[model samples]
Target: MGTTTLIAVAATGLMAGVFFAFSVAVMPGLADLTPEHARGAMRRINARIQNPVFLLVFLGTAVVCGIEVFQGRIAGGLLYVLGCFVLTMAVNVPMNNRLERTDDAYWPEYLRKWTLWNHVRAACCLASTVTLLLGL
Candidate 1:
């Protein structure tokens, strides 16, 4: 595999691990907490997850994978990038912004829906990793 391809697949795999962690551990743990406490924790987490290193991995993988797609392999790069990344920016971020304004009473529904979509993103990231591995 080329350096870019190796980098893309590795970054995507890392992202899948992050998603899986959230789905299996983070979200489930949050479910047991009081809504106000959960919201506070999630708000901090949301901010922390946006650090420079994460962005580089997330977006850098997408950019490299996209190049591979155009080079002829149908790498399924855009599936994860557009599906997971775009959905996060569109649906998840909006919901998170709403949560900041919303009452603690609504946290349950928000958590349920957010986690549901997160699972979808996780699946997409995993799929991206697997397909890229095969392509390599």
Candidate 2:
């Protein structure tokens, strides 16, 4: 049961993280190339997609992983989930919140940090995928 739950949570995290990574990285570059109105529309779309409910779902997956790990199955998978949690809390969330407050003047710099954190997230997601494959 624990292993099953861990795998399920990890899979969800993998998908969300991968999607977020692409959005923060490739999507922004594409947005930059787009016209101003298109960029504004894209930003609005992204904001809607990244609402608190979405964040809760993402965070809830990590919490579920912890519960599964406490049951003594999928230790490595739990580790990866924990890593993702740490990165999210320690880096991504704070940076994102800060970026939200800053004006367009600092957007480029914030975008760089956003991309870097996304890369970190991608690594953690890959780690989770590996853990699932290894069934550790």
Candidate 3:
């Protein structure tokens, strides 16, 4: 694979790991807490996760994947962009925004829905990685 495709594979894999970790570990751990505590912790996490490193990997992966689409790795690139990136922007980020405005009462629904979408994101990234690798 060329450098850009390699980067897309790595970035997508990294993103997949991140979402998987959150789905399997972070969210579950938070579920053990009381709703208020869970909500507070998640709110803080949502805030903190917006930093440079995460944004670089998250947004950068989309950019790399977009480039790959033009470069002919269409399946993998589109999967990441549409399944992961678009879903994130269209669903997860909006949910996060609503979460910021929500009280603890909304936490249960938020947790359920957010984790569900996160699983989808993880799967998309994983599939994107595998598809890119296969195309090579």
Candidate 4:
């Protein structure tokens, strides 16, 4: 791989790692809080972490992944990344907009949907990562 391809892959890997750690591990633990005070604190953390800036960064990283795929016949990776990008723009963004407008009380339901979409995105990201790694 060229320098650009290596850089892109590294960036994608880093983004995916951070996202998996936070979304799958940290956020779930935070969401499991029991007491009202603790729940409130967790909610605040989630809100702060899932802000627009974070989404933009995530989207941008996916774009870089798409670009990296162009270095070779990484059609599968490109397709997966494109699918993820479309889903984020079409579904995730709107849901997040609703989340931002709503109260914390409605977060459980939103979080459920968010988690589902996030899992889909993570799968696609992983597929792309593996494809790139295998030089497929």
Measured by lDDT, the strongest candidate is 3
Q: What is the lDDT of residue 89 in candidate 3?
A: 95
**Number of the candidate with higher TM-score, 2 or 4:** 4
Better of 2 and 3 by TM-score: 3
When superposed on Cα atoms, how far off is each prediction in RMSD? Answer: 1.4, 3.8, 0.9, 3.6
**Top candidate by TM-score:** 3
RMSD (Cα, Å) of model 4: 3.6
- TM-scores, all candidates, are 0.92, 0.67, 0.98, 0.70
TM-score of 2: 0.67
Q: lDDT tens digits, residues 1-136, model 4?
A: 7665565556556556665775788658756764354346655665786767776667666666666667673753474566467777787678767665666676677667766776776666666666666676
Ranking by TM-score: 3, 1, 4, 2
Worst 10 residues of 3 by lDDT: 98-107
What lDDT would candidate 1 get against the real structure?
0.83
- CA lDDT of 17 in candidate 3? 99
Identify the superior model by TM-score, candidate 1 or candidate 3: 3
lDDT string for model 2 (42-115, tens) is 45655776777777756666766666566554664465566667777787668656655655555566556656
Model 3 per-residue lDDT tens digits across residues 23-93: 99999999999999999999999999999999999999999999999999999999999999999999999
Q: Which stretches of candidate 3 lie over 4 Å from their true place?
A: none
TM-score for predicted model 1 compared with the true structure: 0.92
Worst 10 residues of 2 by lDDT: 33-42
